[model samples]
Target: MLSPRFQGLKIIVSDSAMRELFKLGKDMHDVLEVLESGYDAPRKRKAGTIERWLDKGKKTVNAIIALDYNETMQEECWVLVHFGKFARNKK
Candidate 1:
């Protein structure tokens, strides 16, 4: 089941998406890294951006986005990424 906040995301769990995630060296650490980076960036990180980081594959990115939207996991802090750089936004 998915949360109401994530219901808006039309994310589907597909085999190919899962396979691609495995192919991209995905793990709890990597997912957490992406999540942390995604959440701790100023530029409203989109699903596409995270996908790009995940080996530049659309499926990989979508998977991460889905996990994030579903709140299966969350970032420890929030920040912003601007012009390809990260900046801490919280004290």
Candidate 2:
């Protein structure tokens, strides 16, 4: 389950991101937590993103989300398209 903060926005995880999630030992909750509280990745310009940094042990994971609408469902959703850039933790 997700928090009410998400409200009407649907949450989706990409197929490749699923593998990365396992590699980082993270789940949807962890991903949501990171999205809820974020650090702006000003340098990254992937798919016109609202960027955020997520940490997992020695590596820092990137959570790239894209906003999209479901015309058929008549609702908006946030897609976790990419989540596999494991850089060294900055802080």
What tens-digit string does per-residue lDDT give for candidate 2 at 40-65?
66585756456688665786666777
Question: Residue 63's C-alpha lDDT in candidate 2?
Answer: 76
| TM-score, every prediction | 0.29, 0.70
Among the numbered candidates, top lDDT falls to 2
lDDT of 2: 0.70
Return the clash pairs for model 1, or none.
Answer: 40-79, 41-79, 41-80, 41-81, 42-80, 42-81, 51-61
Model 1 lDDT tens row, 17-91? 445556655543444445444333333545443332322332223223433332444432221121121232344
Give the per-residue Cα lDDT of candidate 2 at 46.
53
Instruction: Give candidate 2 regions above 4 Å deviation.
Output: 1-8, 44-48, 55-58, 89-91
| Candidate 1 off by > 4 Å | 1-14, 39-64, 67-91
How big is the RMSD of model 2? 3.3
lDDT of 1 at 65: 46
